[model samples]
Target: MKYRSESILLLACAALASACGGPDGDNSEAPSPEAAEQDAAGPASNDMPDTAPAETGEASGDHEEADDDHAHEAAEGGRLESHEHGHAMLAVTLQDSMLSVSFEAPLSSLGAPEDPQNAEDEARIEAMLEDFRNDETIISLQGDAGCEIVSTSTGTRLVSGHGEMQLDYDFDCENAGGLEGVRFGGFDQYPALLSIEAVFVSDTQQMATELSAASPELKIQ
Candidate 1:
């Protein structure tokens, strides 16, 4: 099912697309997940300003609500919700100790057959799903957070002439406040995926950025 209510990724993408022409980065420095994890045992420092550059610039109040509504509407039945070659979106939400991450991409981007008419196709999709669930694939967290996967679900939908794949993961962290950032590891597995518009939301604020294989971490502050 589409996570319309909980996700602002579509809106983030729309805002970035309008602001930067597309969900593309500006050669900003991406966070190093390895470094963050290495310092996971250090004292928590929540005051560090967000360093991950936002592709959408700053949010203008006048356009926020309208863009959000448009995004939700687009997600319902518009072309924006469908698969786009070489592009995908990742939404990350953190509420208290519960963290939810959802990814949506084109079937072809994940190397899955457009139409799974046989057992081989089904197996291939299942294998892809398995890869997605691996902790080293989609995202990696600060080890000090003590995060563990609580559940996972995968779904597919026909959109236009192609198929779209959705993967959802839920995690419970023992030290939620210690989470410093998330590093995506799927790019190496799917090199054809050109861009991933990633959005992170927490109780205090939200941030958006574009991720690619060359730079794949989203630092939280």
Candidate 2:
């Protein structure tokens, strides 16, 4: 069952750059048939655990505050760059009812084609992009947090033929004040995704944590 789930995720992320032997040799895209099936199975929420809220202490306060400042500075100015293939970075900023999350990963990790020449290849690439921005399933909130995506902006930045893409997702959670836990839904949709170095900033809290396939939850106090 675990293997099955990961397989579904592999299809969901569409990282099969070497297997996409569709018409015209489109190796950097997901096969249409499997992608359609995966789309059908998605949109169903999972039962992820809600961890206890983050802990704060007198000794950790000053250090956590410093880290929080650095996190916000990084997110606001620009994204965190990563050259590693399997590792990605995520930054989340929460203020009042508005929450912003950013996902940055190597384009090669998704098996990006140098350029699409035909309609078929374009469609396949679009499908892969849509899967990457799975929206509701990309990141989820625990309990009745009422976190819903309000806007999304995606783009690619290339430097010397190597590029990375980032997704900026904005959300409005009605119960924003009760923010406690977050789940990286992309984990269940991308098997190749190893770990995400996540930094979160909130009005009264700031924290950094590493999220892995073995543990994909983030506690936001």
Candidate 3:
């Protein structure tokens, strides 16, 4: 069942890539109809814990049951939202209606298409800019590292952390795609850099007011 969910996520990513035109602009290059049919037959992975009764006298069994209960409680207590798009892991925690988005990746995991010193490597990097522009997932910017616009209207913002860190990103709600809408696996060729930028809009303005008032020293412009 776990494998089934993983496969579904993979297919979701493939569909996303295909929507933009398959690799080389050939629609025929997309996954075959038979593959999609097989995927549909796959069962969904159960996220909930098992309900079997525990053994009465075994300490180990009791401990296991307790752990499972704790896990179920944790899962129910919080929202664990995650999305993989453009080869990056995006997770968010929503507390009291406020949302915090975190983007992450392992730097060592990113591979260069060729030697970084090669001209072709530079060309590949350049070509990626086009992909970035086309990617509805990433927001574009014209500034250097440290600080930049989160969005043209929402205003610029500063980033935390330092040294060999991922570039901070300000996602545009209107233009940027939602976390759930992103396609997975298509970003395998890009570098792994993680950075985050956040915006708060809600019925209660207190959260945004406090966040704005407690603004960090980092500049966004």
Candidate 4:
């Protein structure tokens, strides 16, 4: 079941990438599918637990329906490089007992200047990054899952004079059988961020939704 989930995730991501491209493929210039897959599966290879239950009957049907809806959403407006101000892109996947997250956004969306010119500007950037590094300040997983952060990677870059940042996280959950949802905790912390285009892939479900400071939770079973 775990291996099957990985395969499904790869296919879903491929479709997402294709759908994210512009007419001339100019808008598809984001991370490669390979890199996305690595983020999805990286922590699983290490001693990550495998406790999620397999889906059957109506659960399987619901999963398929979710995937179809997600495809439609992607075709409409979700882009690989959703670089709009006050907006960000977030991806989450739960395979076995490992949960991985990939997040990207414009630095200005977090209330930081695009280009840091002095120590004050630099300090602001660092402060925002520190907030991002705190799981409690960024997102929340169910406590019963016994999840612990396994790894994290973050970086910043500039494109066309706009500063952008990416943050990736992996968690090892001792018991993920009933893990169901994650809630974003950054809304109040970074009020400048207005929305997040999010995707969630689990052992039996593929879901996508748009989130706002008003509503910031992604539920996956």
| RMSD, one per candidate, in order | 15.9, 20.5, 21.4, 15.5
Q: Model 4: how far is 211 from its true place, Å? A: 1.2
TM-score per candidate, chains pooled: 0.62, 0.56, 0.25, 0.63
Cα error of candidate 3 at position 143, Å: 29
Candidate 4 lDDT, 191-220, residue by residue in tens: 898887777766456777777877787766
* Candidate 1 structure lDDT: 0.56
In terms of lDDT, the poorest run of 10 residues in model 4 is 55-64
- Model 3 collision count: 1
Pairwise lDDT winner, candidates 2 and 4: 4
Candidate 2 has a TM-score of 0.56
**Per-residue lDDT of model 1, residues 98-208, tens digit only:** 876667787777778766777898788667755655435365664467777776666665533356676666778788788887777778778778777677776555777
For each candidate, what is the lDDT? 0.56, 0.51, 0.26, 0.58
In TM-score terms, candidate 1 sits at 0.62
Cα error, candidate 4, residue 167 (Å): 1.3
Writing each residue's lDDT as its tens digit, candidate 2 over 146-211 gives: 776666666555443334556666678888877776777666556676777676665445556778
As for candidate 1, its clashing pairs are none
